[model samples]
Target: MAASSKRTICIVSPGTARDNNGNWHTADRWARFLRDDYDVVVQERWSARWPAPDLLVALHARRSARSLGEFREYHDDRPAILVLTGTDVYHDIHRDSDAECAVLLADALVVLQPAAIGELPDIVRPNTHVIYQSADALPTLPGVPGRKDVTMVGHLREVKDPATFMRAAALVTAPGVFLQQIGAALDADLERLAERTNDTVEHYAWQGGAPREYARDAIRRSHALAVCSTMEGGANVIVEAITSGVPVLASDISGNRGMLGDDYAGFFPVGDAAALARLIDRSVQDDAFIATLRAQCAARAPLFAPEAERAALLRLVDNLFHSIPSIGKRT
Candidate 1:
């Protein structure tokens, strides 16, 4: 595609740069991936005010429902893709009318991971695609020789289940092990809980929502990354941890299983603080288990490579555009 002849793609996200949430990161990264071949525009919403785009990539089926609906109504002939979020697949799509409508209105559906496919309605399964988000590889920094750190990265929300991680911090008894929690407390109660835990727990620290560079640096330097979220649409933290050669200790939810594989050995039951603590202690003392985790993470790392994600995204757009001969190539 030539520079001026490229097709326009509008990515509708409910979050903006300030939000610094998963949806915004996905929208931003996908735009960069698609920009080489398409004219990509990312906005909070779409309306009649903006010129029509060849395709609309809407994030969060429920939050972006109005934008998806408006774009579909405005250009019924142009294809629109609905990107399912954790809440959408696990909660909203089953109960919310707007979310269900977004599913029906889209020409195609995209799930961040394969496990999410089982959550979608059977009627729309034929058109659904899996597009794993990507992250560039970061060099693995060696852990401090005398101490080990496990970091959990996510906002303090009910779905993320940060309480479990905080409780696990109290339960961990391994020598020279520390638990680090990164992310802003989106809820006041959770913030207070984190503060109390930090005050009492000898080896726990709550470093609220640092810069992206700091978070990535922490992951690269850690012994393991902990993701305690009960629901996830394929977490970007998992991708970052895998790409950085840091193993993950994840909740045994379908979304985490989809990202780490069913056979991975690093999962603890969701919300089981004792189980997470046991795993954390083991990850510190059991070198063999850590090695196994590293190997498994390395095996899955290729799936999140920048090249693979870009190719998959480009292929989906190309196929969707080609499916309709009349509008295959935008003038």
Candidate 2:
């Protein structure tokens, strides 16, 4: 039966509205997806201020730790979900007390891609679910009339490893291939490096940070997207690329593997610029390789459809609520 009344859900994300980061994007998207079924509010952090929500969905265990603890303390049986991020899984949860506490408090854990599940502790495994981030199914567009550019989107944080893309640009043998890097610099050193690389590397440009639509437009028109992250919960850029009918050449990390499948041919080793260069060269030199990557990415597109993600998210929340006896009793 359909619900009699709308439920109130609160999302706790560390990213600010102006951050333009992955966490902010996920929080924003999920709020829109849940709005029809529930009254959703996206917050930088959960507070005990105005009114209590029926459920809480906190992104980044460590970042939202205090908020999670507050909600759980007041209503232990009320449904709460902990969404894991790159830092949470790859680093924090293992050593950070706050992140670990969040793991113990949540009724369910959300991993953006399947491989993230492996990063969880055995005790947290049973409750964890993979929720692939999504994008609308865009019709394939005619190729852009410009020099071929492969773009990489992600802030110039150490984890994103923009250096790999820069180094790979210097190594590729393919002619007429330009590299475009999007996103702001989180590290001063990396920012300086990008500037230097742009001047020295042939056919490379760093278009530091752009509006979401601009980044999406760049990806949609590019020959392929390159993602060289050292760690990722699941890069939102990956789904954006796939749904836009652009193929990705990603780092061979679990997060990328989880999204693109382990056997995906478009992956290069993490930090291996030469290998990425060779792969990029092959993509530029051989039409078949490019076609194969596009085909594989196309097959994964359905999994990232908006409807599919909304359904999975609803089911996970609904199941958790129904199983917990005190779900509706909490005030």
Candidate 3:
């Protein structure tokens, strides 16, 4: 074991920086958040060769199950946290045995939004905690007169439901309304579809696989951010939008409801392109509707602040450490 003064924390994430997906970003942000207090290391997988950590924080129950299971098996005394992603909350936990096993192995469970707790088994509910992700506030770009930009930020993946956004591009007839999609083409078919949409729709553009800074700037410049996901543990993009002073038009789903609140006025039905298009059109034609959305997002902004997220995260870590009197004394 390596000699270290600060107790080490290992974060296991299946995705890497190159992927630029939600899991990787979450793991990276968490590593930054916890670094001030602990020795934090983020890895795609945890291995025995690494110095034993005082705590293990694994993102994605199904994907990180093997590492989480092994860590608990060897270091039963140490705390292990399992963060349930969109797939785990809405899909995998109900059907996947490994995901269920991972749930049981965790000493603490984290859900990105509160509604996700309802998706977990009764046994896991008590241990589950909601931690809304955070992004630093960005300067809201000045809106160009006579132009309305609605931006969607997520990789071209099935879960993100990019097709809905593409189809909505064709349906939206409101002049000066441009639908911009920014993400990597994780799916070849979606890439081709995005290309077709760009060629056919006068107001749609696909700027593929941008750097994080670029994406944030795009969100900051947009009139409203569109989160068209079929599932989301809690979207980091939504937080970025709120912090950047941009409103959101989200898909109506449990995960989104948890993030935006049930009464949020800007939701379109899941996978409904026409409905999404109508919402886009309404946002362009009705300034009052846009103002309402902005006010609602502003009300929720503090919840996603870095200070609040950091305090909640540290509170959880401190509680876990104190619960086990001998947590950092491991050989």
For 77-159, candidate 2 gives per-residue lDDT tens digits of 57899999989998899999999889989989999998888888899899999899998877545554656778999899999
TM-score-best of 1 and 2: 1
Residue 236 of model 3: what lDDT? 92
Worst 10 residues of 2 by lDDT: 322-331
Model 3 residue 210 CA deviation in Å: 0.3
Cα deviation of 165, candidate 2, in Å: 0.6
How much is 48 displaced in model 2, in angstroms? 2.9
Instruction: Encode model 1's per-residue lDDT on 1-331: one tens digit a residue.
Output: 5533778899999998899999999999999999988889999999977888888999999999999988888889999999999999999999999999999999889998999999999999999999898899989898778889999998898899999999999999999988999999999999999999999999999999887778989999999999999899999999999999999999999999999999999999999999999999998889899999999999999999999999998899999989875663644
**Model 3 C-alpha lDDT per residue in residues 149-211, reported as the tens digit of each score:** 999999999999999999999999888998999998989999999999999988899999899
TM-score rank order: 1, 3, 2
Write down the RMSD of candidate 2 (Cα, Å).
Answer: 2.3
Instruction: Predict model 3's lDDT versus the native.
Output: 0.92
Query: Which residue pairs does candidate 1 place in steric collision?
Result: none
Clashing pairs in 3: none
State each model's CA lDDT, in order.
Answer: 0.93, 0.90, 0.92
Error of 3 at 238 (Å): 0.5
| Model 2 pairs whose backbones collide | none
- Model 2's TM-score against the true structure: 0.95
- List where candidate 1 sits over 4 angstroms from the true fold: 1-4, 328-331
